[model samples]
Target: MKCKTIVGLFLMSTLAVFSQNASVVSPNKKISVELRNSANTQVGGWYLKVNYSNDGKISEVFQQITLGLDRADQSFSTALKYLKTSKPNLINEHYSVVHGKRVQCTNSANEVVVSFENQGKSKLNLIIRAYNDGVAFRYEFPEKGGTFVVNDELTTYCVADSTKRWLEKFNPANEGLYTSSKDGNLQQDWGYPALFNTPDKGCWYLIHEADLDKNYCGTKLSNVAEKSKYKLTFPDQWNGRGQGEVKPTITLPWKSPWRVVIIGSLSDIVESTLVDDVSTPSIISKTDWIKPGIASWNYWSSNHGTKDFKKVCEFADLAASMGWPYTLLDWEWDTMGNGGKLEDALKYIHSLGLKPLMWYNSGGNHTWVSSTPKDRMLTHENRVEEFTKLKKLGVAGVKIDFFESEKQSMIQYYLDILEDAAKFDMMVYFHGCLVPRGWARTYPHLMTYEGVRGAEWYNNGPEFTTTAPEHNTILPFTRNVVGAMDYTPVTFTNSQFPHITSYGHELALSVVFESGIQHMADRPEGYQDLPDAAKTFLKEVPNAWDNTKLLDGYPGKDVIIARSKGNAWYIGGISAERFPKNKTLSFNFLPENVKYKLTLISDGEHDKKLVTEYMVVEKSSVVKVRLLGRGGFVACLKPIL
Candidate 1:
């Protein structure tokens, strides 16, 4: 009788361990996510299986999505009861932004909220959304106003070992190059917006997070447990100058940020607005003052140019000559010499009808210990005082630098500055910062983030001379897909160090990189010496676009893209290989039966020069272009009117 009783209890417990499962699919039925709550699995207590449909052929892209919640009070990771799933609902909305890859965007997804109860009876909700482009999910604690301590989040993603990935090593500032590998080896930390490609399945995936706010700490991926599995890892003790805790302490009734997996072809990865789709909409009501345009920056040419009043005016003159609307007065404007003060430079800039942007150090012991103009933007009172004075002086924007941390406090600091800046109608740019994760959508006044090893690195080291070409090709697929990246591109002349990329490659960056304020990094002399056609193209490049499309190429080898502003289209392409590449530019994306004039600027026989040609073409025309090793090209298409 005793043995029979023990056997009955064991059977009941086994059944309870793997109780319920649910699935959700995209509205188009192309992507699906399946959740299995099995307490016995090594993937925490819950795991997800994701599949994608290509031409009616289904393939599994993700094997497991480990999920759990550890709190100081209780563990939501084990022995959870599945309650019920809400009916799938469609969310389709359209919105416009101040500046981005495109002016307008659409957010459409099919969503379902799955409910659960932990052994301690604490309720948790898992909300999943499936879009044609990707899948996103997040956790929610619906309980009322009480405090909770999140010891850790046990969310990990597992994929097949054969998949190729371009992952950047984890850093607080997110300023590292992406390493492409497929050796089944893992790193202790990998940054977000990690790109993966499954050649056999004909699909691409980019993993990132969205809707991140002050309530939580930023996270990255760590596959130290298993090479193919990457779990969510918080910031290390060294980050934020070791000032803040790695764990997040939050108030109740809070939903964690969405873990977004962008899935599709390379085009889908490039053109998808899935990151913006999952983030919060614009919180600022008045966005008319926020404008996107090219800016004449002196830092690339003379890092301390602001100290010389003549140098400041030269850049302002460059902006005026190029028909750009703004000139950036880089750091040290506070100590201006050689015939002008801060007010004097502002007056001169405005006299030329150019808006002036000033730079500031983020002002903390956390980073950039030696930079000046520090501590002016660290608090609300300081920002209000500074911004009020700037607004009174007609300063258009503020470029705050050196925030080298991803802790919850730093994240809140970024938000606080944005919110405060908006009140005074000032646009903001962040340098020495974390990669953008959809904050541009939430804060329209936020212009750009310099979280890349961009042109400025040319001044710092010689390694960029060789690695930059490959890095530039990969960014369109990885970093820039999330938000505006301030690469400070288009330098025709050398900085302290010379770039090995060709003149045509330099010209193409003005189009290839998307930034709210595209900083033309060359000196005035460089622009004056450019061919008439190339200079004209520089003047016509638009910072904001109406539409964008990825035409061809791969991650590290080459890339071609076409972007439209109004009725005109701009095409940019670059090659990263040591050997030359030949590509055919098919205008099939153009309106059928329409004639257009194409102005093509391509690499010359030599790397230092550029060659320009003009031709009349239609939607059916296929123009061939040759990119020299480490070279590029750009073209403009306007309907023959």
Candidate 2:
């Protein structure tokens, strides 16, 4: 990490009735955050305002910012005394990741810390950082060696009521559809990573949090929002079956998670690494054991195949045939039959040179599921015992599922699992869980999370058949904007329920969705029946990307994205409309004056088949393509030597 002092500290008299304000701008000077000590603290204490600059003109993106906290004894929300503001520090650092939208990332921002004293003379600090792509802030306690229970957080984001927004209704599992709204008048509770498009501002921003640890509980935007002001609302008391307190109890010298608002153009929102940039860096120094790859998942197809050892071996064979690295053994592997026992299945999987990822149910009163391998990951001792055993059994990772609560204890449970899994050098994928808030950066082995309404929903009901096409198009801008999402992309065959999306659309998901361990949710036969070109593309496509580019399109209507790995680039486009959509591929993002081989895969005459074409291309080349209604396409570019 590198830092430079940009401005000297300005001290203020520690007076009870003082008026003071401070401001910090991004390195590029395109965004600024202003904090003011309100004269009338009763209404609120230390309000904030965020502004964006365009062509030397300034405009407010967030109308108002509310900050405060209520402790068991003291209230930091209002009637506070003002202290000095720290010097502006330029944070210019670069970090690399194991697997993400990009391999290289930047953490550049200008930060300021403002101190204050509550009515009881207790000290509080507000730390704010302004980045070119967004702004973030968090509260800190300067005192040391004490414990306190925070009854409430008075922080809030005041978006204009007229602003267009895409918000998902709140659910413990964080699995729900994002509904488009003209304003914030719909649901009182909405999930994090909400999307907004400021009217006439040409700016797009996503609201979320980063660096969430065991000390803090996950939060959501509550319609407690008056005048379109969305306040931070804690998880329900019933969370974790009423296990732990919703409010956080913390030791002194602690800081709250960074509340982030990523702002910029659509491309900036899609490609920005601000979430991970602000998160804690990787704790694991040796990450070569944490390999990212495509996994052949059995649940989406068989759902109960782990009980049948023969069926499990078939999928293992399928993975070996596809040249993939891992095979996920879903629930009920404890009751295996046919091909001997769990040990025999592991022997067969290892014989095929593939690492196996086993599944576990996060047991407790929190979830109602009756799956086996339950109660094995709830406590620290249990996780240590189980992870140690799995490590001895040659398991590469664990897909712990059914964690449907977000209370403080549950948050701690999630982190405990990640930390313990790392001790065994095993990767992790969280299912039936909250959306990732940059945990991957903190724990590199924390590969992916299933917090979206993914393909598994197709087997749950009929709604997904009709809703999935539109849902697929909206995710890149909404759910996927925050972190790695495990949507389990690309399935051509139907399970207990059928999908109406075209074969090409299914193929496009391999490139459209970004997951450290991208699970191919199809039967072995489904992949084997594909054309040679399509099969070759699947065999070579990468789950981890070097860079990502949002080429064109809109949410719910259509989308086109290009991702690169080494000298090869992969492009994906999907359409939700009922009619064919035409798009022109632009190669301008490629290396200048470089020739390449282009392999294009598009929807066939019908939904069941796909057609592949080959061509020569370069940086200046433009190719026109069409997608069938409720369909999609995938293309690959390899720089010709």
Candidate 3:
């Protein structure tokens, strides 16, 4: 019996963990991760040796992947919680599929789940899943009696000190740039859709969050005490004024959001749906009312000069003329009501076949509304009343802004608003808030999140303050990968000529950026004055796409991407921050057998002007482009008979 007991003990620790070198490959065997425990001399609690397989070359990307958790009373943590954890038994695992309903992306995917547990009475489980696109895992605390306080959740993604890191500040306002670095040095405790570039080893990993609900407050990643490692950090606290320590008290059987790591080439990272896949399935059973498309915005042009019903109607007419679906009424016009002005304007917009998206401050912001903004929507009843009134007025969507807090209370408010908005058959856009972490998947009506330093920054000043070209280039892999971004791109005006990235570069943003509700921030006159090629793109560009392909480029530098919808494809390319003299692209992403008419909207001889070209291209065709100082290009390809 002693002999039998020893044999079982050895098997329990060794079998579930496999070995330090042994790993599990993804279903397609493209991605693999090796697991090992510190009990066996691995430094971390448990290490993940991740490898990527491209063209059959197995490259180890992440050598040390481990995580830990801590509590307030210091009673438990991922490090010591598992110390008394014994038997490390492998529980049952399986494969599953999640469908994206009412969205353009449609597919069936394979997912493999691996679960493990301690055989002792106190059960602390760790579960990991290897999807063809990426890998994700979370801790499971399953005891059921009462509440507990958690101090921290430590997730470490270890990379080489020499690796490239695009670090972003943890501004709750979501306003900042992705300054590049080598040692992962950050000015503040920050988190972003951070990109870790180690191309030589064949891995460009994107770190982000997914499926975050009320269970936990928002999390951002910061550097660990040890060099060459990054760990998860939460807002220190929470209240009305700004972000603060999150109340970590929670009920039994809680889990963390899937800490996601997307690996592959730049294209693979750009086209990943891992965040969407791991998110909660759609809560709205009937989603036909949710629509994704472009909008004409008013904030950029100072609410179209005089925020009245007449000026708003002019913008609505402009939207209809551009074949766009919505016109956003921003500023005090939507909130102050302007003496029943918004109601009249929205009704007129609907008659023109254009929807009206009104803007609102997420309570307690004295900036927009004048009186009783507090008494407006402080409860469930208030939200239902507001949404019901808007639904009756035929308002299609709302842009709620200035959340500025990452507390659980604010997070819960977001869920409550989304639920209430859905009941009224309205689409939603959240601004001045958390970066979208798979909320679009859960609340299909949630179209976009303006957690990006997008075009709105242009309002801060003249040309110099405008959204920089490099910022646009780096977003696809980070912010765009996590979910739809409300960048409010596409500005075509001659007044901002001196500071503008070339006209072609601005045009290219249509294809390069991904958002459910793409907003045109330029003035109405700007749209009317656009070259025919620009107008054509404005009408044809899609807010949601069936597919996306990253052809080539680097982070904070030049990038080219192709996005498709229905039968046509749109491609966007932008120069690096410094702006290049020119760029050349291959039409290889197009089907080899399909002949197509490719129209290129490019920079004119003068950087300030726009030029367009048309050609019939075969599979072998290569197109050379000139991008003078912050320039870019946008093109549309349609298969021709």
Candidate 4:
């Protein structure tokens, strides 16, 4: 048979089998579902897919299945238990559909609850709930999962409350732009606006998983420009199961997990009730041996080849004087198999009152550390001995480099390294690796990872100018939401020349970006001659924080972030270009009835040749202020009380 005919036959067979076990109990609410047995041969496995209206306003979708043995065991176990027992105990059996209009739906196994109620002229509540193991909170619409012709308009709904507000509140014109559908042809605002509010109402943590086939997961939505497709992936640490494959061999039948989207306006009630029962707050591991503080050399630095014992000691001394705690000796320090002694470098770094960190490749082709080593080199026995030797040499941390391909085998390899490193009390920094997915919480000594596009590219060439802005903006919302990023910050104003942001903007990033060990990404000489004001700002920035708040803005246009370490508050804001009008910043999270001393760096007046030298210090009762064009600001605030 032809390919199209084969696919049509397959889908027809699958749909017919699905229809036998499925039905739409609520057609007006657009809630539909199907369920089958684990051994069902027609579709190759037992499966269920539900597309429903959530809380009357949002439309959502969910899919689950038990296919082959490997995936079937786990998927079937969870699905069966949820359908049979867990869900029935949790759902509110009787609830009001609207004022003076009470409705009751039968409670049954594998049933998903869908309800919609008109709230006001422009607002509605779309709710979907499964008493069993599956559940999701989302914002859905009419044309969901369907193709749209060009120039079509779409309406989006949200709960009208304070706890959860849409991104449109910040930029009214951009709201609902992310949800529109688009044809194969390019056009702007093809997607819709989406946000997720959880019981954990602090920062938005997003997980995106792309399969080896490059199939993107997550909620399908449009972008403001309406030219692209966007999807969010479920958080899977093992990236499914087995190496290079999502285990269980199940096709589309398995419901991976709910793709959660929260309308912030109704965050409090929704987060408390709608989030999946399986989702929980992260649990961070204990780091008994690893110490947290500033570090000297990062993965990419200029002073590598020329530094001898004397120069190394001088740099260590400078770092010690600055109240920084550690120093690093990166790649090439070891001669691989030629026998370089790590003791000599460790001794000198320690002599300067700074802890020492060394670099090693996780699994590479180098003569010293090859993935497929000849003789005893590739075995775990030999690697453990090498790690033991490094530990004796006083190495506090090991920077593991170059596990470039994120395959299942590589994931296992890194997990093994983290386990072995823990045995020797050595901390780890992963380079050329994927973003952290709460790994730091599981292995605290895994200080940071280099999945982000960081400062190293800036020194290389022109690509830095184009990519840095969006990368910086999206990271906090996506990657950093889960854990720390080892993005080396603070390249001096002079080093970046004309392409860089002003010194103040650079200075502010130390607080804006979240990392465990924030490296001073510039050379020692870069900050040596900076003004005293800028110098003081750099010196006092902290690497860790007790809390962080995204005050306003989005990925590309602009972003403002505030973090607190102890009593001090460090705020940083950046813009893509000089805006024609001023933007007002709000500080609603600050403690009320208290005065603060604000020291700010912004655009200089006409006379100041140094564009970054502008400073403002004032006592402020109101936490709102207007920032100038193309202008960014960094401020350090200490409470006057």
| C-alpha lDDT of candidate 2 relative to the true structure | 0.88
> How do the residues 552-625 of candidate 4 rate in per-residue lDDT, one tens digit apiece?
76644566777776677788876655442355655566776665667766545411112333333333333443
What is the C-alpha lDDT profile of model 2 across 441-537, one tens digit per residue?
A: 9999999999999999988998999999999999999888788899988999898778889999999999999999999989999999999988988
The weakest ten consecutive residues by lDDT in model 4 span 95-104
Per-residue lDDT of 34-147 in model 3, one digit per residue for the tens?
666667542236666788888978766788777656655443333432332222223223212222211344222333333333333344555566666777766777667666
What is the C-alpha local distance difference test score of each model?
0.89, 0.88, 0.72, 0.46
Off by over 4 Å in 2: 1-21, 38-44, 56-59, 225-227
Candidates ranked by TM-score: 1, 2, 3, 4
3 or 4, greater by TM-score: 3
Return the number of clashes found in candidate 1.
1
Candidate 2 residue pairs that clash: none
- Model 1, 1-641: lDDT tens per residue? 99999998998775554333367888888999888856544233777778888998776778889888888888877666777778888999999887888778989988888888887778888998989999999999998888878998999888787889999988877889989987448556888889998747578899999999999988899988888888898888788788777788889999999999999889999998888888999998878899989999999989999999999999999999999999998889988999988899999999999999989999877884767888999899999999999999999999999887888888899999999999999999999898888899999888999998899989988888889999999999999998899999999889988888888888999888999998998999989899999999999999888988999979999999999998999999999998888999999999988899999999999888889999999988999999999999999999998
Q: After superposition, how far is residue 542 of candidate 4 from its true place, in Å?
A: 1.6
Candidate 4 Cα misplacement greater than 4 A, ranges = 1-85, 88-288, 298-311, 335-342, 364-379, 493-498, 578-581, 605-620, 623-631
> 1 or 4: which has the higher lDDT?
1
Which model, 1 or 3, shows the larger TM-score?
A: 1
Residue 518, candidate 2: Cα error in Å is: 0.8
RMSD to the true structure for each prediction, in A, is: 3.4, 5.2, 4.5, 14.1
**In model 2, what lDDT does residue 584 have?**
93
